[model samples]
Structures are given as structure tokens and as C-alpha cells.
Target: MAQLIRTPKQLGVVIRNAHARSGLTQQALADLVGTGQKTVSRIENGHDGTRMDTLFAIIAALDMDLQLGPRSKGGKDISEIF
Candidate 1:
């Protein structure tokens, strides 16, 4: 399933849930990403701003892909330009 993440908090929640589903602890994910556990914790909590490189690393490590698309309209994908 694809989720449109419009906020950092949403991204945080997705990553946290994904980590759990993958059976990885904060420390384990940190080790995989070559970062600190505290950093992962902060990111999961959405309290600490994360670097783009780090965010991409985390996403990749979790076997997730990030996509960019045109803005949605009223809770639906914009399929018509007119």
C-alpha cells in the first residue's frame, strides 16, 4: 500500500511501524544505518529533525521506497488537468 506522507510526523509513524514489522529494534536499525540509536529514537518520535541522507538511508534499510507525485486534490489523486 502507498501512503502520501505530507508531514514529518506522518513519515515518523510510517518508519516506526515499518521497523516494528521488520522486527528491528532502535539499536538494530541504527546499526544498520550506521547511526546512533538516539537518532532513530528521535526520528521515530518526530521531535528531532532528520537529515535527508539519513532519512533516505533509513527508508532504504527498511526496504521502503519514497516517491514524489503531483499534489492531491480533496483526498483524491488528481487525474485531470482540466
Candidate 2:
């Protein structure tokens, strides 16, 4: 699924929702991602800047895929042009 997360708040919502949907507690997900509960909380609350590797680990733990692409131009829909 392609999601347009333009801010930290949006990203936090996505992460929190994914974690909840995966039925994992903050601490549990943190453990799986080799981080601490506080870190997870911070990320979920959009407070701290999470490392890319840590973000990927969290995504993996939640069984989600993260893709990067350019934003749309001229009001066009964002699409993966790569």
C-alpha cells in the first residue's frame, strides 16, 4: 500500500497503528527491534528521530514494507516512477 506520510505526526500515527494491528505491545516491539520501550514510545509519539535501521526493524516486525519515492508534481498522484 502506498501512503503519503508528510510529517512526523503522520509517520507516528502510521507506526502506532501498524504496531497495534500487529498485536504487539510497545515493549515487545521494542525488544524485537533491538531498542528500548522509551525509544519506541518516543517514536510513536513523534518526539525522537529514529534511525533508518531501527525504523526498518520496526516495519519488519510489524510485517510492513516501506518504500521511498519522489513526490508527485503538478497535482498528479504520487506514483513509483523508479
Candidate 3:
């Protein structure tokens, strides 16, 4: 099955969970990325309009990879094969 990201909020939830699983607090992540705790909180709460640099920093801090590709037509998507 394909995992679909419906909204920025949903993405935020995933980021938050991943961060927790990696044993890093929001403040610690913010410090690592040279951002403030409030910014991290906003991101965690699904606030869209975050800067690309901020997003990249968050992804790096979480030790996660960001992938972009076309959506699936019906059931399985080409992205799943990769």
C-alpha cells in the first residue's frame, strides 16, 4: 500500500513522531538547526509555510530522507518500487 501525505499537519505529525523515536526533543532539534523552540513547535503543530532551509534542517536533524515523486494512479505507485 502507498502511504499518502494528505496535509502539512500530517507531515508534521510524522516528523514529530520520528523525532521522538530518535530521542531528540523539539528544543534540542531547534538548537541543532540553529532555530528557536517556538519555530519547532509551530512546525510540529502542522503550521505550513515553513522555509525550505528550515525544512531541510529538520529533515537532517531527524536523520530522515525526503522524497518527492508523482502520485499513484490506482493501487501501487512507481515510487513504491524505488
Candidate 4:
């Protein structure tokens, strides 16, 4: 399934969910990405200052792929969930 992420909060939710699904703790994910647990916590909390490199590293550690494309007009809007 595909999800549309329009805000940092939404992105955080996705990352947190994916991390849960992967059965990895924030500390564990940090270990995999060679960062600190606090950094993972910040990213999962949607801290906007997160560096692109760290973001990519965390995503890769979670076995996730970041895709870019035109926003789908037919998919569920993230606002509905919040």
C-alpha cells in the first residue's frame, strides 16, 4: 500500500509505524544508522531540522524507499487521519 505524506507529522507517523512493524526499537534503529536514539526520537517526533542524510539513513535502515511524484488526486488525504 502507498501513503501520501504532506507534513512532517504525517511522515513521523509513517516512520514510527514502519519501525513498529519492523519490530525495532528507536535505539536499535539508531544503532543501525550509526546515530543516537535521541536523534531517532526527534525524527520520529517530526522534528523539522532533521538532516537529509540522517533521514535517508533512517529510511534505508527501516527498509523503506522514498518516492517522489505528483500528488495523487485519488488517494486518501493525510488530513483525514489527523
Q: Pick the candidate with the highest TM-score.
A: 1
Q: Model 2, poorest ten-residue lDDT window? A: 73-82
Q: Residue by residue across 1-82, what tens digits does model 2's lDDT show?
A: 6687766667788999998888889999999989999988888888757898988888889888888777656564453221
lDDT of 4 by residue, 28-59 (tens): 99999999999888888987888899999989
Error of 4 at 34 (Å): 1.0
Residue 13, candidate 4: Cα error in Å is 0.4
Residue 20 in candidate 3, Cα distance off native in Å: 0.8
lDDT score, candidate 2: 0.82
Clashing pairs in 2: none
lDDT for model 1 comes to 0.86
RMSD of 1: 4.7
Off by over 4 Å in 2: 75-82
2 against 4, candidate with superior lDDT: 4
Off by over 4 Å in 4: 72-82
Ten-residue region with minimum lDDT total, candidate 4 = 73-82
TM-score of each: 0.85, 0.81, 0.80, 0.83
In model 1, pairs of residues that clash are none
Give the per-residue lDDT of model 1 (tens digit) for 1-82. Answer: 8996777777799999999999999999999999999999888887657898999999999999999998656644443321
